[model samples]
Target: MFFSFWNSVVFIIICLILFIRFDTSDSGANNLHLFDANNAAEMFGNDVFFEILDPEVLRYTYRARPAKDFGVTFNETFYQREALLVPVEPPDSCGWPKNAHEIEGNIALVERGDCSFLSKTIRAQEVGAIAVIIADRRLVVDDDFYIEMIDDKTERTPQIPAAFLLGINGHMIRKTLKELDMRYAVVNIPLNITFVSFHEMNQPPWMIW
Candidate 1:
């Protein structure tokens, strides 16, 4: 029994030493890093912004990505009325809504499935929506959805500001669609929208010690 206990102690000591050695080297914790500016040139010219769509005292900060043709970094604070999710049919998954006329000068709320994000945003833009909000399909996207980078290489970027909304916030706005007629209510059916820019457009999350 004594021999067995001594062997276990030695094994643990060796493990601790190995762990400390590896952790201090390149192959261990030191190798982990944040994903900042993977391709410098590609992301250097782009600008990420924040959108304030809330009317209450608490304003939610939503990251905004500009389309390729969106041009240089600029900030604007404006209000837009949000509308219901449009239905996309077969033959290219392009969406259309019955109230397309109402969306002309308003923001379009589209679900994050059934079609490509660009397709949804393009449809909303074609119908004359100033901005498109792609709601996260999952009830609550645990990670930061805004950190995702938009690839506008092959596919053409949507002209209107295409913003992604996490499930919780997106669903809340979606729920207001049911009360479209209740204009005076706290949340507007076609909710007011705002777009503003900030620094640090391509900073990635840190994943190391």
Candidate 2:
């Protein structure tokens, strides 16, 4: 049940999504609409924090604008690999283990810095990772609090999918390891994305609570 993170968790993000199951015209539509808004309304607020089951740290799930047919219907559970919090050396080099045997066939949770997104992913993939989750280690901007990641922007896209979680969540993961008597965690993450209006998201911050 152990998923490695930076010195990291099994990172099971059980992404709970009930908004799409109910119809907009249905009685629950009013409430379910709010569910939709919470997950997808990054401009107003980013997705809520999810609990990791085993090594137990808060997880952040992310969604991206789908591009045509290539779009993944995040409604399905995706990336169920046992999370391996792969280590990054100082000066920001990923693939610290360097040995593929240690990380083959698992999701590598890597913190963002010291290298291009491609290098981190490509190295992990070369070793044998099923997917990659890039956790931000620093706050570069307000949006850094959200699940965000950028591809290399090359003509070629990775065979695997890579996404980001906020820096706050990353710190939480680290804290859990230091304070708790745990080794790592495993997670199942489901993704949800929907359109949100500025008006719906403009309520007072207290009202959001």
Candidate 3:
């Protein structure tokens, strides 16, 4: 009887340990490196950012500005999503995507122009992109100010998130992918911006200050 009681006790202990470990891992998965508002303002200025979490060599945070009048807005509730950043086939994404199979369940990186911002987002949304990042074709994106992605007066609005990226940053991302022969890059979007100092934040090595 004593031996049976001991066995039951041991089983309970083992179950408890497993449960604790699982809970810890789940919590850790949701936690991300945070940056204070001062850090965010200094580093990205008016832009928000996303982090490249995979291909350790390409791990860096890039600047972006969320659209004002369309799609879901970024907030605590909309944070903590990880997705593959895949470039559209036509780049502009004016028409239906040729690589819809690859774009589905991922974020589409479409070039700005050739269509209204709304149209580009709609095309990506139709193919099941969780979000869209419109990259400017010009070298400078309005001198660090966000170019408003106004409503195109379309009857339907995109249901997913959309943001604008600077041409230089976008070109670098595409160039790096091509050089590495990678089809897509793993990314964590809409990272929570805290009020921590830039020095305390987990800054990528490639970024200068």
Candidate 4:
């Protein structure tokens, strides 16, 4: 009877050791988190990236035409303005500005060309933009802006809350608001983003070979 008891204790110790190793090694192995449009706000406190699942997160739309075409005469006004604009000659690796730390609280005007929509969002998050607006570099006429999150392996789960906007639409909104002498309205995004864990197997594995 004593020998059997000792054997059970040894088994428990081995199991404990295996559990610790597995848990540490597979940090994000089974860590799949999902969040929707409405509940995204709740995930602000958490460190994990809040994935926005709705197209409505993309609010504004704009045209890719030149500012002069819209009868805006001041060139300096466009450059010095706080509004985000997609560059005509976007960089090969399009990302938020290198000095993006300065624009943390401000909006990120991202150029849409080389990378995926998810990449733009990640870049915006890195720079500390509360929100991101992307403009298409393609210069397609009458193009209504639409951005979609492409599911790719490189798309690491977001560590910050993010959203997408069409480049042209975002530009038009900013321009119109400025022309009307109106302050850019703050949008309160109501999202239902959350993290949850559940049991899959009937019992935890005793050992991993």
Candidate that scores best on TM-score: 3
What lDDT does model 1 reach? 0.47
Candidates ranked by TM-score: 3, 2, 1, 4
Q: Which scores better on lDDT, 2 or 4?
A: 2
Q: Could you tell me the lDDT of residue 65 within candidate 2?
A: 25
Query: Which candidate gets the maximum lDDT versus the true structure?
Result: 3
TM-score of each: 0.46, 0.52, 0.71, 0.36
Cα lDDT for residue 130, candidate 3:
85
Candidate 3 contains a number of clashing pairs equal to 5
Error of 3 at 16 (Å): 67
Model 2 spans > 4 angstroms off: 1-51, 56-100, 139-148, 153-156, 178-183, 191-209
Residue 150 in candidate 4 has what lDDT? Answer: 47
Q: What are the root-mean-square deviations of the candidates from the true structure over C-alphas?
A: 12.8, 20.9, 14.4, 16.7
Error of 2 at 181 (Å): 5.9
Q: Cα miss at 157, model 4 (Å)?
A: 1.4
Over the stretch 53-151, how does candidate 3's per-residue lDDT look in tens digits? 866776877767887788886566656466799988888999988889999989999888888988998999999998899887655454535477778
Instruction: After superposing candidate 3 on the true structure, give the runs of residues whose Cα lies further than 4 Å from its correct spot.
Output: 1-47, 139-146, 199-209
Ten contiguous residues minimizing lDDT sum, candidate 4 = 200-209
Instruction: Count the clashes in each prediction.
Output: 3, 15, 5, 16
What is the alpha-carbon lDDT of model 3 when measured against the actual structure? Answer: 0.77
Off by over 4 Å in 4: 1-93, 138-147, 171-209
Per-residue lDDT tens digits for candidate 2, residues 130-198, read: 665566565333565333445556544556655555445554564565577444446554322345444
lDDT per residue, candidate 4, 45-119, as tens digits? 321121111122323211122211112221223222233322111332254465455447654555556776556
Task: Tell me the whole-model lDDT of each prediction, alpha carbons only.
Answer: 0.47, 0.47, 0.77, 0.40
The CA root-mean-square deviation of candidate 3, after full C-alpha superposition on the true structure, stands at 14.4
